[model samples]
Target: MIVVNLDVMMAKRKISLTELADRVGLTPANLSIFKTGKARAVRFSTLERICRELDCQPSDLLEYRPDEVPQNV
Candidate 1:
């Protein structure tokens, strides 16, 4: 599974959602989806823009996490 650490990066950079959206040329609603990990897919161009604005790499924003099984199940 992939995890998005957009909120973490945004906090570290002291950037608001509106500010980042404006800088990245994306709508706040769209960026919110990405920030919240609700996005099903993201374009490379978009990722590049975000990384450029955040001054970070894709690896900083994305993480590979193995899915955890439900112990109760």
Candidate 2:
């Protein structure tokens, strides 16, 4: 399973959702969905913007947990 580590990275960078959203040119609501790991899919462009604003790599934001089961499964 894939896990979104957005909140962790944001906390490390000391950035708020509203602030990050503005910097990444996305609405806070939309970013919130992604941050909460409720997003079914994400665009690479969005990931690039997020990584750029957070000053992190894509691996820092996403993680794989093979032990976890998918909710829908």
Candidate 3:
């Protein structure tokens, strides 16, 4: 399973959801969905924007846990 570590990075960076959303050119609601790991899919452009604003790598935002099961499954 894939886990989104967006909240962790946001905390580490000490940035608010509103601030990050503005910086990444996304609406707070949309970003929130992604941040909460409720997003079914994400675009590379969106990921690039997030990583750029957060000053982190893609690996830092996403993690794989093989033992976890998908909610829909």
| Model 3 TM-score relative to the real fold | 0.93
Please provide, for model 1 over 1-73, each residue's C-alpha lDDT reduced to its tens digit, 9 standing for 90 to 100: 6788999999999999999999999999999988888788899999999999999999999987788532222
List candidate 2 stretches off by more than 4 Å: none
Question: In candidate 2, what are the lDDT values of residues 41-70, reduced to their tens digit?
Answer: 899999999999999999999998898885
List the pairs of residues colliding in candidate 2: none
Q: Model 3 Cα displacement at 47 (Å)? A: 0.3
Pitting candidate 2 against candidate 3, the one with the higher TM-score is 3
Cα shift from native, residue 5, model 2 (Å): 0.5
Indicate the worst ten consecutive residues by lDDT in candidate 3.
64-73
Q: Model 2 lDDT vs. the true structure?
A: 0.93
How would you encode candidate 3's per-residue C-alpha lDDT over 11-62 as one tens digit per residue?
9999999999999999999999888788899999999999999999999999
Off by over 4 Å in 1: 69-73
